[model samples]
Target: FEYAHETPKRNKRKNYLTITTGAPTKRSYLCVQSILYFLLLLNSVIAIIMWATNWYQLIIYKVQVLSNNSLNVELWKNPTWQPLLSIYIFNYTNVDRILEYSEKPNVKEIGPYVFREKANKVNVTFYQNGTVSYQVRRNYTFLPEKTRGSLNDIIYTPNVVLLSAAQMIKEKPWFVRKTLGALISATKVSAFNNFTVNDFIMGPEDWFSKIGLNLKRALGEDVPSKFGLLTKRMGLSGNFTMNTGKYNTDLVGQFEYIDGRPGLGKWEDEECDK
Candidate 1:
């Protein structure tokens, strides 16, 4: 009886040891599982952060590219009237191409007048006293029908003389008169490549509209609807005349707001305002 009782006690002690050991093993497994879950969560958070940053950068780059492209297209289309005038002035005085001049007459000054003609080109002479005379020609020949309009009618008159105007005077006041004389003297310089009727007709707004149309066609349904809406709101439609008047207003206003702004001709700003 004693031996049987001792054996039962030993068996009970063994069972207790087994239960304790198994409990520790189970706890270790649980701990490992919890660590793995934590690592997974951290990785997911890092991935989300990287993805968001990339998306933001992409969006910013896209906006910048779109804006720059739009501006470039506008410049290409409009080519600014001042630059064209500069080119014309350069051509008139520089080249020996002006017909009817016995010699390359020294053009002492230019402007305080707006002069334009339908001929391949036209020449305007500005004397010392501010009186202006212009001749129109087709292929270097005076075309009576084409040149019928008065200087006021034909030329898109300038608001200020290229030299005597306040803006030019202020920006280069000391050299204003001298620069005008030099420009006339140097009229025989190279012709301006970008000046064209297309540039003359198309304004900044027209350029944007044309670019938007082309973009729309290229992108088709891939373009975002919101972008299209924005373009429309910015007046990127085909009606250039409406925007032309506003842009002209802004241009004139720029000169007016500046301290040394030139005194533009009444008809010059008036025509553009209309």
Candidate 2:
């Protein structure tokens, strides 16, 4: 009777032990499942955020194109023409700057004009006389260094605009002289109905000096001739003046206040010395 009673107690203890162990196992499984669900939720949230942002950008880009004029094929193939077209299209479309050129030589002919958030606005015009002009307007208060090169490259790509004024004079001396004379004559005829070599050439010394200066500046060394100096000086002076602002009258008084200060010369360095 005592042994049978002990057997029932032993059986009861075994059942309790099993139930305690199983309780902990079920709790661990629940915890693991909860953590897995949280991780999946987090991943889904991140993916949704990325998709929303990208989709918004795409929609904005599409909406910005107001006209189909931007899809012209001739403008895409010609680098010289594309810059001007980009300026007009962007201005009319009221879109942010995003045009980019392709790098691959083969595709370079095709172009990869993409919009970037931070590009300068270029004013482009096509004249009735078959000339395409590009004017770059810097958005920043301070001027950027690369702006000049960018403008020149856009206008002067291969077979685009003709050579620089100095290059044209050198390569076609008679033609340049005749053209300059004709332009002066036409202007005079329209105004006072008279023209002369004096009006067109400035002076023989001035012409030679201007040409020599331009050549020297363009080639970056003296070419050992009167004409070379003229070209270099002319080109250098023209480029310098075009890039810089005119001196302020208020600054002139301040400059005169200094002892032994030089007056502003025709060029930029001279003005700095004052």
What's the TM-score of each model vs. the native? 0.17, 0.17
Clashes of each: 13, 26
lDDT of 1 by residue, 65-104 (tens): 2222433324423334321121122113422433344455
Against the reference, the lDDT scores of all candidates come to: 0.34, 0.33
The whole-model C-alpha lDDT of candidate 2 against the native structure comes to 0.33
What is the overall TM-score of model 1 with all chains considered together?
Answer: 0.17
Stretches > 4 Å off in candidate 1: 1-28, 51-53, 63-274
> Counting only residues 3 or more apart in sequence or on different chains, how many pairs clash (N, Cα, C under 3 Å) in candidate 2?
26
